[model samples]
Target: MGDLGLFGPGSVTWKVHAEPILMVAGLRALLLQTLHPRALAGVVQNSDFRVRPWHRLETTVTYVVTVNYGTTADAEEAGRKVRYIHSRLRGVDPRTGEEFRLDDPDLLRWVHVVEQESFLDVARRSGVKLTDAEADEYYREQLRAAELVGLDPATVPSSRAEVAEYYESMQPELATTRDTVESMLFMAVPPMPFGLGWTPLRGAYTGVAALALSMLPTWARQRYGLPGLAVADPAASMAARILRAGIMPIPRRLIEGPIYKAAMARARAAGHAI
Candidate 1:
């Protein structure tokens, strides 16, 4: 009926991304990204995430929301800004002194792959019922997300098996750095606003963060020296499901971003049942 961004209302990407569990999925992706030394080095050198973590988080949330739920024009504009920033930023690997561009296809592809995997994995784990075929379709549909960030969609994995192979291929290149440790530690205990750390809200945040960490692969968890308890997996899933159950029913206008609202209104105006 109308433009519904890269993945429309009926698409799997929209369905998976709309869930509240993606907040944790995003954290999981961040944790996984740090396992790549080049990725960690690039971020440490280029981003101000350390000093203004909340701002960084806000910027990222806005980008994600806009790209996934905004109109095609808005999403493309967002991508242009991201690509411009990546094109201008340069950094060197702390471990090898090897220089890298933020827009490096390999780095961008790695980020895209891990991010999509995190979203899909967390959604399924949190009781979003997706069959294997639908899961693969989800990955296939997400190629547009990769393309939005300036990557050639052909370079990105388009299936679950391809994603696994991509990870396996990357394993030889992944490693830990001091920056990685600091990043993960920050994830574990990011600075709280004024007095928010003293309430049950803090524990709720911790549960989400721990759930994110628990979903990391054992090897990656071991690389970061974060405990990979066998029991944590099921517990994390339960926590995620509970959070999703509680959050998904909230009024959409209160929870969704303005761009999401606009797009949905457009779809509705076009006589779509979304």
Candidate 2:
């Protein structure tokens, strides 16, 4: 159970996810996921996001970090909990008046792709320097996460080109519904835990929200009433480089939590430090 769950220490997922800029990528993923009416419906109907948004965000982050760095038993237990929760949730899609299960493969695929694509997008733009082949490998590696959510790995996109094709096919189904707008607004000033002063986090989160808007797909931006103005790609890349420079220099023991520390311990035991 102490073994790396699915991705070992050298995995592309580990390499990409270790960067702090993935926080931005995560915000982007949440933004993208809310665009799907059915998926958004499931969230709105089943979760207390409207009243306790940070709880949902924290739970999602915890699950991801656990799978990425936790032991096999920990990862399996986390996935099992998620599956159990999803299995019990059913919601009616407000837009189409159609009922859908939370665990629907199509919905899961949408969530998986948006999240994986966002992680890579932020990593690349922020100066992680992954080659095209490495990026594709990262996507291929991410199929493991999709599978954890009950998706068929074979149907998941495994490369940038395939991801683009998938998005193209999904464009007709994408839109800026009221839920999307609400989610965006909520994310703008994401609820932080009490006792941690908001003043400390407000500026950083505002920048993230702005960047999420700037980096959105043109059509999505326009639908959300953003100008669809493109920020030069290098801008995000440069910002990411600055963030990496600022963060990576800190010793892991000072900045990381238990999950990352355990992963590093495993790496050390395997004869290297991650």
Candidate 3:
């Protein structure tokens, strides 16, 4: 999965599904921080988002490029190849009880944009500063992939509003939530493993929680008694403990099933599914 060209040799559909995971992870990181503040101190350090890790950054940027271009192009074309083989599986749409088509451009664009915005917001809050030149470079490198997905480099939008307008134009092609989720399921899942290292899991989970908490608004931070306002740096201390322990064990069902589920449901209802 790591050796191919930027768009690989697959049908356009595969690239669509694969491109947004980076954005999803990035956005999730950002929202967790913005809504929780203290969370930032846990999972990431200052170095994780730097330009040096262009491969990692490319994944995150892909979504943004998709949103702006409806395909990979200009600044989002790097890292497009994947040679690892896996079995093909059917994708079912939960909402309509129908199968989702992998080559659907609308679905790809929607997920890409939403995920990119989410990642960008989080990266900024987490202190991953990007220079204008870096941002432009990212866009430039993505041109080839963008063409593969049917986007023209000359037509790419230059600003956020233009990007939003481009997305709105694609509404007719977008799939329902059920279809979108099915597409996402074919993508990657979290990196956590089951069993064998309970201590590391605990440390990681605790660290993630602490980082998410740190991204909350000031008032929210005060409510949690996080550092920089009321108490001495509780967030920092908790982070240190997480580092010493190696992994933080958070009950998976508790964090994912309930907490994350409830928040996402609320977000969807509020018209912010991205």
Ranking by lDDT: 1, 2, 3
The reply for model 1, stretches above 4 Å from the true place, is: 229-232
Off by over 4 Å in 3: 1-90, 131-158, 164-191, 194-197, 209-274
Q: Between prediction 1 and prediction 3, which has the larger lDDT? A: 1
Which candidate leads in lDDT?
Answer: 1
- Name the better of 2 and 3 by lDDT: 2
Per-residue lDDT of candidate 2, residues 1-274 (tens digit): 3476678877888888888778888888888888888888898888888788778777889899998888878887888888888988999989779889999989999999999999998888778879999999999988877877888999999999999999999988887877789888988876666755467577777877888766667667777887765665456567667776777778867867788878878877877655
Model 1 residue pairs with clashes: none
What's the lDDT for residue 237 in model 1? 80
How big is the positional error of residue 177 in model 2, measured in Å on the Cα after superposition? 1.6
Quickly count the clashes in candidate 1. 0
Clashes of each: 0, 1, 53
Per-residue accuracy of model 3 over 1-274 as CA lDDT, tens digit each: 1222243232232223323222334534344232211112211222243323335545545444443333223323422331011012223443345654433343333433444334333333333445544443444444444444454555554334655576556444333233223222222222333442355755654445445445443443443344546353455345434442432254435423232244334445556533
Considering only N, C-alpha and C atoms within 3 Å, which residue pairs clash in candidate 2?
Answer: 125-237
How does each model score on lDDT? 0.86, 0.82, 0.37
Model 1 Cα lDDT, one tens digit per residue, 161-228: 99999998999999877778888989878877666888888898888888788888777777888776
lDDT of 2 at 49: 86
> Compared to the true structure, candidate 2 yields what TM-score?
0.93
Which scores greater on TM-score, model 1 or model 3? Answer: 1
